[model samples]
Target chain A: MSGPDDMQGDMPEMTPDEILALDLALGALPREERRAAQLRLRSDPAFRALVEGFEADLSPLDATTDPVLPPRSVWEGILAETAPQPVRTAAPVSAPKPSLWNSLALWRGLGFAGTAAAAIALVTAAPQRQPLAPAEVATATPEAPPQMLAASLAGADGTPLLSATWDPLRGTVVITPAAKPEAEAAGTTPELWVIEGDKPPRSLGTIDISGPNAHAISSQRIAGLQPGSTLAISIEPMGGSPTGLPTGPVVATGKLSAI
Target chain B: MHGPVVRAPASPGAAELVQLLGRAADGDAAAFRDFYDRTSAKLFGIILRILPDRGEAEDVLQEVYVTIWRKAAEFDSTRASPVTWAATIARNRSIDRLRARASRPAAPLETAHDVADAAPMADALIDTMRGAASVHAALAALEPRQAAAIRSCYFEGLTYEALAEREGVPVGTLKSWVRRGILRMRAAMAEAGATA
Candidate 1:
């Protein structure tokens, strides 16, 4: 594939269709030209084929570029817009004011240092911490209106181990551990599971034990999350349960409740 | 000369991606998330090539994924590879943004000159090197000026007028260069496909 072809000087003229297809594929046409090409694309199958051929020819170049990891916010934004929205009652008569749960700054500040219990406490006390005037409340109804469900998992002795908040609208569950899991010290990892009734526990995947872990729930699993569903943490070998069923001892479990 | 490289089925994960997209079309959010995790970086890289600004690239990346989610059902595996289909969306969105903007920043024409060089592939895309190598080989077969013109227009998302102005050439001449480049590339790729 290397070495130049000898047909440079004898190159044939590109027909008008070829020129238009090339220009369209290259995205080099001006607005007016593009509109015309688009029209042809819709009405003319032959022209569209040429364009597709050009697109396929050019696409390999995309693979020649290095990959770049986009910031997490981009994925968050995508989930916000595309995640399935659960059926709910109409907006509250008095819309809820923006709270710490809605604040990115607060989340960033909490980072990994803040305990899950402390975060839950802050969420519970957020209204009092920053009391909004009636006018402010009326004006501050967040777009999409935050719908959050939180669960505070506790060890057998009733000691809070971790707290999780599920924002269905955002399709994410933020899990904050109060401290390093005992399993982490024992060469095993703590895995989160969602148990809904008689069905086997479904792994929500291994989560970061050291800090706040935000796991995006898939649409299928998001449906399983509700007020009564139980969230449990289990100790599993390094990666997580290999059999899809929890093989480790259940360390903590909690029931999700609407916040 | 090296034997012709097969173009389609560039990545081994192509079939898995097809399944993921099918699942996403069925409104499986988990499958969609899996798809996103696997493809976002590659799409982001494609978008960033055209829109150099990180903020702008990120915005396009978000837009691209949303489009992918919405249009997953429309994906025709017989027509294009999974990465190509997604990359086309990324490139088109980024180019649209580039055209809408008043000034081009970040990806200058000079930077696009390096496009023929082998780029480091993401771990998920390591299997695509054969396809990329064939494309590089095809581009390498063109006249330097024609190859450069095509690369600049593609990687920088430059319109004929913009690229012509930068190259200090007439728009018609620039179009001729690119059109000829496209034809030669198609021929070269066709030849490679046949040999493979």
Candidate 2:
């Protein structure tokens, strides 16, 4: 009624094409321009839902709440691994050259680096670094800041996932999942919480409960971490809960630091 | 944008295993001892596949190792090759900083690598692909131009501007083409039961 294209009198209609374009755009933009785009999309209810479904793709990352980097020593460990050839190794003018076995040791180190890279290649489709020798490591670009993890949601249960620690630094907690989630189908998503003391669970986020896969609970999922017993994930809604309490059943559970 | 909600079938032997990625991230003399014992040449194979900068690809190696150190916990043996999973993560990270916004008219296909991981969880992913193939077939049934636009948008990551450039049409018209194409494609994919 406010805009010229508004269906003030006649019901509006959208061709499938308009809906698709909007669906495509929905992947790039947010829901704010729905009014203007709605006209382009012809305000079709089914199309709108389709667009919503498309946007749902990025939810997995959203559910995670870690600072990309953890407080763990892994970052330091990585730095140490490629700690560099000192960048300026004193020009090595008069030092005695190392023997062939030393060279073999270096080759073995290189081989190890190579193997590690290969192992990573076999696991993730992501690129990994070549193995570094005992020397020749270089300093990383200081400007490339590590990713930051943050809390996203909370729930009725006493457990929550925590924020993520960026690359270069990572620590971990493992959880044993309950039997098949459908074993307790309440028609809600499994909620995750970071638990500490006797306090209510600090909601981290929720995990998908629709399937029968073992969900990995990472520290990068806390809503607002507090001192708690462990990180627990329960079920909740797509957008998550308005209340902090989790109304869903617990799926995977783990302690942040087994105390 | 929210990429896709479909849970990427769990990654097996993902980069999260400490025993797997310790040396790479550790960069320590002792750790690298273990690191090299695991994965290597495969990492190079994938990086070399896409990134032409051998030096740069090698540079990414360090980051990948560091990522492994910090993320080994996230890896699951049920997903895919540690290499493929790690490669995907590395590629995504590399492109994340280099990626252009959706509004850009030029689609960087040369720089883009298709999201193909090795064949471990290939079974799970293959199921999705079979499903996608059905959808693709359904898409094939649509008007050629219309389907082209949808394919360009969904799989190719093209903007409307780029679509127009590819088709040599006006932006507004291209916009219309994409919209219509998607509508038909969505219907087709859904009817085929390949959609999530």
Candidate 3:
């Protein structure tokens, strides 16, 4: 029976005219009309493949570029401009240095001095961070300070899809909702995975997705995700894939580039 | 030769970070201060990639942080974390700044194509704030041929056909090299204990 969790590889493909219509539906329309066209085109595999082809053509855009960081005071200048008018112009260079929070991130970066945030947190949180069962491990409390996330893994082509800061030694991997191409976001669950040390990718669970998208994994759950593995996102069903073979198209994929 | 000493400590969670960013958005000078400190250096790195020169990059960096403070309100908490949002602002601002600068008597920017061949996907590619070093380190681990193919495609602005010609391989072979290289890299990272 075609119940839940069954794979549907037998779907029919799209025809040339219909494919063109779908392409036009997406390409030559206002944002509102495009959204409508997307709905119309969803049932057509050929059209979906066409769209997927476009994404394939564009994936190289995600390749990681090496950006050289500048002095900390420069950012101070930027932020100082945001202060009230009087504060903005008058806030002299004697700005109070950010507490450990400011310096915390510097240590986390590869170009900077000091150990990784994660390594530092281990020392402080060792007393509290107890090991747990696998499933429970998925939602463990982080030993690192608050401000760090676990989304800094690289996608395909060694492109980083996340960034981070450190809090009392734990690293933060900045994660955003998987930015789906136009006409995406319907009936798809974007799930994250971590691949460490040749082990098959383990599920890091689903990102919140959409506007309210939240990065799910933090320090407590980071271990289950595995480090140094490529982080990937595959478009699964509403919940996720049961086969674990990346059944749906991969939305974005990156590896864990530890800096 | 000495590199920084290190240990693998734990990382922070996104939920907590959203809250921190939320505070920064609400005029928590401390939060803004901390965010600026944490992200500016990385933002500077991103700026330098596009802008190159030190003075110009610093100027752009300053403008980027200003934009972050003013636009923090527009941030969709779920859409992007503080770092990603900040970095995006920095990157986009840098691109714009670079465009303006180049228009001031340098080579044209809109040469053969406008920006990266694929922008949104490229955003997914180049613009992602996934930790820079870890991802690059993984890329470094790939076979030279495979890595070169991927890098050329992503960074050096080489078309697959162009890459094929340079490598003395068929176009299809070049494509396969990039694809396989990516897959192999993924496989390698999986072995490296990577998590999302």
Candidate 4:
């Protein structure tokens, strides 16, 4: 029987550069060179794509090994670690504070006192928080409140350009100008877009670099604010992208993920 | 041009995995559990290959899933399939652990001994995953020695020097085989439309 290796006679030879790329992909390079190649991947798109291609090419090798079932407790441990920590509330009080260390009411009162102090301190520190009507503030949920997503958007070069956080409950996307190359920030306003799987990019709103970076867009307006979507920032005109689509070079991109 | 290649056996459940990852990213606990059940075994196997110690491998596997939980929103299906994306994470994490442990000198001998007796059986290496048949076909195309070098380097996270020493070949010869083997395998996989 003609074995599979027989077909290798016709296989084309790989160039030295191709071999080096393959070596880098296999993690077979010497220590110093491997580190150099990995650093290059961060700043070089062509190099990154080449490495990624090797990853994709060799991924099938993973299938050859049988899956070994992990212990069930591992899953439990993951859940325990990843589960959102509930904000600790003050313990219940059976009676009024009794100046006794063991009394539940004293401890509960102390907890409330500390919480109130921290809230006061935070409110004092952040003067930018717009004061809400007491009536509107009272409508906030009593239970575990909805959390927002904050992502640090990076460019293809892996440099942080803008820090963004979208609060679904509050209907706001907060953008903070970060360490971006000067050329990227010059001559254009930064516009944000949300891209879901295979869907057209939708504009969330323009980010005001001079003013508060927070832009108010309801969750109803942006469909892909959830996970599996990407939050990309592109340079645009003062009013935003005139064509309603990202027209300029994408300076930074980050996928919308849980904080 | 290497365009997109369809992964045959595209069941709704497979597609649901991507959606489930999305929900898990939203901190939906149930969806996260389902994602773990579907994926953890394969990830565990990948980690175990590098770490050798079951306990350490399990620990790394746990970290991998947690990273997935935090970064599932970053799982762009357009960029990579779920298994490939996850395997990359597992491999990278395992490599990181391996590097951290490299300072200690107790590992090489034990790992070399294991490699001596641990040639995987042909049948044991086969699986029903969609790309397995194609990959196996391409790997089968290599010379047996070339294939072993590739497998040992990949599965065990062996460096060229380690693999060369273990196989009792000059480092240069082994490098030649590995590079040539990889090129042939890539060609065959591309022909099979299995290259990413």
Candidate 5:
């Protein structure tokens, strides 16, 4: 619908080759033109050479760019999203369409059931202590934001597999796995790791992949909760990684950004 | 655009980068991690400049690597260096995101000062390839408006129409400027290489 707004006033007539080269460089060509160029890239040596030359000329713009470090969670998210170890879920006759694992509603819709109830009970039964907000009574803090900084651990397909939240006030890390990962065959337990800056992940504790599990994080360990730290879930052997590192594929992971 | 020199981990040279990419193509997680570590920051910067939102840039950066993971094997070093190939992908994806948002009234352009400005890599890195210096020299030789058109088009991934709109110039003038700018830079860079 929107043509390059029909170039106005006294345009010099250009050769088709020059226009094609410029169009490729700017990616301004319509879809059909782009497809034709791509076909030319494969089939027409002269055209390919022309395109590559333009790419070379323009590439310095890329080379001189300032480098900005992305948040640690980005790489972790990439790993969790792309790490394609075979998922042990029962292979269905037809594969289910890929779902958005990042949706909190999807997890909530799955009926966290008793695990959800237990999470509330644990939050309540545990000392109603507010380490930082001493002025306000802990009893009044809402269920979500104030008490917990959560990471939704998803499978390779972005299916929400586990939810790990760091409850700073309670000094505990709560992990609620949505459903049993069939990967739990033969005594393998899901281990949690705190992935921090360029450091080898440190084990938070082992968690049951089939149910809700909580680990009391010592004050010394809570220091890792600095923004950008991640809670990574990996399927490890019965006793967890023998070397105190993540020995298995990181199945699910989420970042621990401060609220 | 000049700023304080910030030294970074020198780019992994072309050969090693290609090797890492090939390994990643074969589904080697460790190799992919190494590839990501070396390039993500640079790629993030490019995307951030175009998008100007940290969260959106991060999301797009993640998408770039996932695309890289799937398509690493398709990288033909004979045609382009690893950085060029990957940066092209990043640029294209960022543009796609920009175009998708064009229909709606987008947020005001965040000025360069407003974006979290990281110190630029020092000249040593910039000059590692003689081609880069020549390219910069070439850009410097252009008329100021022509050079700005080229940079804004390449860096922001703006189409001729969008750039024309932003500059309040006729699309024909903007296109001519950009086309002439590219041709001029090509000659200047080739000459610089000849001297080298």
Candidate 6:
């Protein structure tokens, strides 16, 4: 398959180690060779350095290709997969818990049926907190058993900032904000916390103030969702409070109630 | 050897990405989302080039981000820039998918032409990065066949055996071309870094 006069002269010779590193970096090694090279990478610092060097050197090529915005569904899929799953708990003596897929179907089937009742409960429970708009309540399909626990959080000035709903069966909390929270100070972020009587606050993770977000709760933490427990938002350093307790002033607070 | 340059919009600086990754490691989904918004397009570009099929490429993209989330703690800023680290993951995952398939699909026409033409697309598009120009410059300096072999191997994730068959050459010859090209490029990059 060679040309009559292929130009093979003046080519520099590469050591086998260098070849191995190049192949590994390029993802070109056969399966067996790849496994062997990977093992070598862990044990051989010099070989590892070679691979890293090649990877760094070759990385600039990434900038050459035109960036294409992947469809939004890709991000949605990522969120679904990466969202925390309900921690497995032992089956109760009486009845087995439904599988996640089954619960999700049941949840969808009950959609909007209980929203009006839930909104009324939210209004009567906290007069200071702004109620969900009438338009939102008007869209309810019909009365289905209420299956969600909800809270309407407000700032100290009595202005509604956000609302939260906990779906116990799905083990997810959906947070919908009325408006974007004020910009955080440099090096800090707005964190969500669940605080029950006497115990220290548990972080629900940093909240996205710009839009609605859903977070899965583990069964152990789900105990914090009792009717009188409080959900608060506080400003914490980038990742969150290192001490596992709120270190800044509370920006908003609301009480959880079953609707 | 340069092709038409397609400039990417300005992205978050490296330091910001590092910070975002740190927060992500701490389980900050918001920080993770911000990171994804800033970086996904570029990583998707890298994946789509290797995989070609939109569905396959998008699936691989999802897998890559999930990996980034799980492995954010392992990122070492001292070793590589955040973009490079993420890009490496994307490339490796896409290549893994490529290799795992029962039979390699025919190379897409644009990719085949790019390799055959030996056009240094990287040099044209990556001029902003400090040493990028030199890497592509060195690539352009290589013999055309050697350069083609390197590009095919890197961008298409073609193994020596696969590439050799495609080019109607011995696998050893294909490997030789890539190895020689890599050494020259590395040396050129080092020289450029030293001078800079």
Q: Top model by DockQ, which number? A: 4
> Which digits, one per residue and each the tens of the lDDT, describe model 5 over residues A189-247?
77787766546678877776556877787878666475456566666778888989765
Better model by DockQ: candidate 2 vs candidate 4? 4
For residues B1-196, what per-residue lDDT tens digits would candidate 1 score against the true structure? 1222246554557788888999997889999998888888788777777877778788778767776776676677877777777777787667756655556764553353223323344343654555667778978978888788898889877888988898897777777777767776777777877878
Q: After aligning candidate 6 to the native by TM-score, how far in Å is the CA of B12 from where it should be?
A: 7.5
Q: Please report how far candidate 2 places residue A28 from its true position, in Å.
A: 6.3
Expressed between 0 and 1, the share of native interface contacts present in candidate 4 is 0.41
Can you write out model 3's per-residue Cα lDDT over B1-196, one digit (the tens) per residue?
1111121221353344455567876778788776665555556655555555667778767766665554455465543444555554554445434322213233232231213222122122222334334445556766677677676544333345555776887765565555544444444444443343
Q: Residue by residue across B142-177, what tens digits does model 4's lDDT show?
A: 788889889988887777887888789877778777
Give lDDT tens digits, candidate 3, residues A111-158: 111000000001011123467789988976545333232334222111
> Which residue pairs collide in model 5, if any?
none
Error of 4 at A257 (Å): 14
lDDT, candidate 1, residue B43?
82
**Highest lDDT among the candidates is held by which one?**
1
How many pairs of residues collide in each model?
0, 113, 54, 0, 0, 0
Residues A1-259 of candidate 4 have per-residue lDDT tens digits of 2343334223245544455556666767554455445433433445556666677677778876667777788887677556666333564543332212222111111111110000010100112447889997999553343655666665432234466777876688887755312332345676788766556668887776443467888666764467546676666776889999866545456656555
Candidate 6 stretches with Cα past 4 Å from truth are A1-14, A85-259, B1-12, B109-128
Evaluate chain B of model 4: give its TM-score: 0.80
lDDT of all predictions? 0.66, 0.38, 0.43, 0.60, 0.61, 0.65
**TM per model?**
0.56, 0.33, 0.35, 0.56, 0.54, 0.55
DockQ of each two-chain model? 0.18, 0.05, 0.11, 0.24, 0.14, 0.19
TM-score of chain A of each: 0.43, 0.26, 0.34, 0.42, 0.43, 0.43
- On the 0 to 100 scale, the lDDT of residue A140 in model 1 is 74
